[model samples]
Target: MPPCNSTSHAVGGNTWELAVVWGVLYSDSAVVWGVLYSDSAVVWGVLYSDSAVVWGVLYSDSAVVWGVLYSDSAVVWGVLYSDSAI
Candidate 1:
C-alpha cells in the first residue's frame, strides 16, 4: 500500500477499506476522507450508514452503491457526482 495522508483502517470486518485523513485540503479547513486503493479497478461497492453522508467527488474504477437510511431527513444528488465503475 502507498503512504496514506493520515490514519487508515478496515471496515465490515476487513471487507471494505477506509482511511482517516488528518490533514487539511487546500486553504479551506476540511477533514479529508479518502478511500485509498492501489488500483481503481473494482466491480462492486456497498455503503451502509444510519445517519447521512454527503459526498462531493467520488473517485472509483468500478460501480458504486451508496446506501443510506434516515427518518424525517432530506437528501439530494447532483449531476456533478461521479458514481461509475470499470
Candidate 2:
C-alpha cells in the first residue's frame, strides 16, 4: 500500500485468486458513494473521510450501483474497493 498523510486514508489488497472490497474517507472534499462486486467477493458499499483515496483492483469485476467521487488534486469522500479472495 502507498503512504497516506494524517488527513488521508488508503485501503489496499493483495491476493492471488480472490477479490477485495473496502471504503475510504477524506476530509475537505466532496461526498461519494457506490457499489462494487467481484467474482470472489461482494461489496455493498464503502465510506471514507479525511483526504482519503479509494483504490481498486486492476483486473477485478465490478459494477457501479450509485454515484462515485474522484479527484487527483482534491480530497475525496466515499467508498473504496480493493483486492480480495473471499
Candidate 3:
C-alpha cells in the first residue's frame, strides 16, 4: 500500500475548501483517479486505466460525460459506462 497525500485551503470569505490537486495512484498497475469540486458540486473527474482507457466527467447544472474507450472509441453523454459499446 502507498500513502495518500492531501491538503486544504481557504477559498474566500472564511470558506475553507479541500481539493485533491493530484491524482492518487493505487497499486502497482498505475491506475489514477481524481476529482475536483466547487460550491459543494462536482466540477470534474478523471480516471486513467493502464490499458489506455481514459474517462472524464464534468458537471455544471447538469451532468456531462466525455470519454475514450480502450478501443479508441469516443463518446459523449450525460452518463458514462465502462463498456466500450456505450
Candidate 4:
C-alpha cells in the first residue's frame, strides 16, 4: 500500500479487501466499506448513517459491487459463481 492522502485509509477485513489508491482524498469520517473479488472489475460503495461517502477513482481486478444503504436496510446480491473467485 502507498501513502494515503490526508485522512484517507485502506483497510482489509472479513475475507474482504478495501484499498484506496494513492493520492485519494479522504476525510476523518471517511471509511472503506469492503471489497469482493471476482474475475470482472467490480466496486461497491455503501453509506452508513446519514453521512455521505465520497469515493474517488476505484479499480477492481474482478467483479465488484457498490451499494449504499441505511440502518436496518437489507441488500441482496446474486453473483454468478466462477472458478477465479478469491
Name model 4 segments beyond 4 Å from true.
1-25, 29-40, 46-68, 71-86
Badly placed stretches (over 4 Å) of model 3 are 1-27, 62-86
lDDT of each structure? 0.38, 0.40, 0.44, 0.34
lDDT of 3 by residue, 1-86 (tens): 23344455565656555543333435456565555444333344445555445555544423433443332345332443333343
Residue 67 local lDDT, model 1: 35
Candidate 2 wrongly placed segments (more than 4 Å): 1-17, 30-39, 47-86
Q: What is the descending lDDT order?
A: 3, 2, 1, 4
Task: Give the higher-lDDT candidate: 1 or 3.
Answer: 3
TM-score for each predicted model, relative to the true structure? 0.22, 0.20, 0.32, 0.20
Mind giving the per-residue lDDT tens digits that candidate 2 earns over 5-77? 2222233653244334343434454544433333343344444433345432232235433435554445554
What is residue 57's positional error in candidate 3, in angstroms?
3.9
Query: Residue-pair clashes per candidate, as listed?
Result: 4, 17, 0, 8
Instruction: Please give the distance, in angstroms, between residue 77's alpha carbon in candidate 3 and its true position after superposition.
Output: 10
lDDT of 4 by residue, 16-78 (tens): 343433322233555434332222234333222324433222333455432333333333323
Tens digits of per-residue lDDT for model 1, 1-86: 33454333555667544443222222123432433233324322222233345444334445553333322246665543345542
RMSD of each: 9.9, 13.2, 8.3, 10.6
